[model samples]
Target: MGETNDVTALVAEVEEQERELVLTRFTHDDAWQLGCLLVELAVERRLAVTVDVRKGPQQVFHAALEGTTPDNDSWVQRKVRVVERFGASSFLTGLRARAKGQDFNAQHQLPLQEFAAHGGAFPVRVAGVGIVGVVTVSGLPQAEDHALVVEALRIHAAGGA
Candidate 1:
């Protein structure tokens, strides 16, 4: 790590760019699940979560994953933290912007919702219906974080929900 920038910001930016690149198109259903799964993966790993998908330049799609028995304060904070740090501009990309009428080919690609102290995110691609996005997971150890997202995607794909 040799540079003149805040490491966290740098990492976030990189993740944001990569995510934007993956989302080559946009689909309403796919966008919703992407955010939902991001939260699901976070809770699975006992981490808090919130996620959003953007279409075009300024459209924002957001969702929060809740914990059992009503509300999870920590999870709420996680959503708040992520939203505070990475908003639509920083996270949503041009692909999603351009995917308006096109058919997004990426199926149900997801992003790691957790931010790790070490940095690095799991980038998955959902290419099928003019929609694409990265499954970014962090907070937990690298492999563990990675697994959390991958597994979630698999489950969703299998369930067809």
Candidate 2:
């Protein structure tokens, strides 16, 4: 029961985040700023992670902090695919799948190597345009990866650095 309630609350929080973090507009400059901010935050916290921001298939910004490997980049790609395919945060997609007692891979029929439902990728939704791209981080625990992206998004959306 406690686990269920926790999942319910987390789902609500993520949903609210999705609604509230909508950008007025997303440009190349915006992606750069957001990606740099994520790097700054990770650096301040000494987090060794890789950050990526993309507008559609074009990557606007990407950085891999020290201690991250090529595997992190692969994770970012997989998680980004999840956001692109599901139109939601990868974490949220996984949570919803788990809540429904469904296997994400079995339900979605997406290859595990190409699409990961793990946290860290978030849709870059514009106020009028909907999801134009994704911001993703890798190299941390799943929830931590998701939280890092969310924190960066919250700061970016609020015009804070």
Cα lDDT computed for each candidate against the true fold: 0.40, 0.92
Predict model 2's lDDT versus the native: 0.92
* Candidate 2 structure quality by residue, lDDT tens digits, 1-161: 88778888888888998998898888999999999999999999999999999998899999999999999999999999899888999999988887777878889898889999999999999988899989999999999999999998888888885
The pairs that clash in candidate 2 are none
Candidate 2 Cα RMSD (Å): 1.0
lDDT of 1 by residue, 80-157 (tens): 333334442212221232233222122223222432111122333445543233344334443344445445555555
Lowest summed-lDDT stretch of 10 residues in model 1? Answer: 88-97
Model 2, which residues run further than 4 Å from truth? none
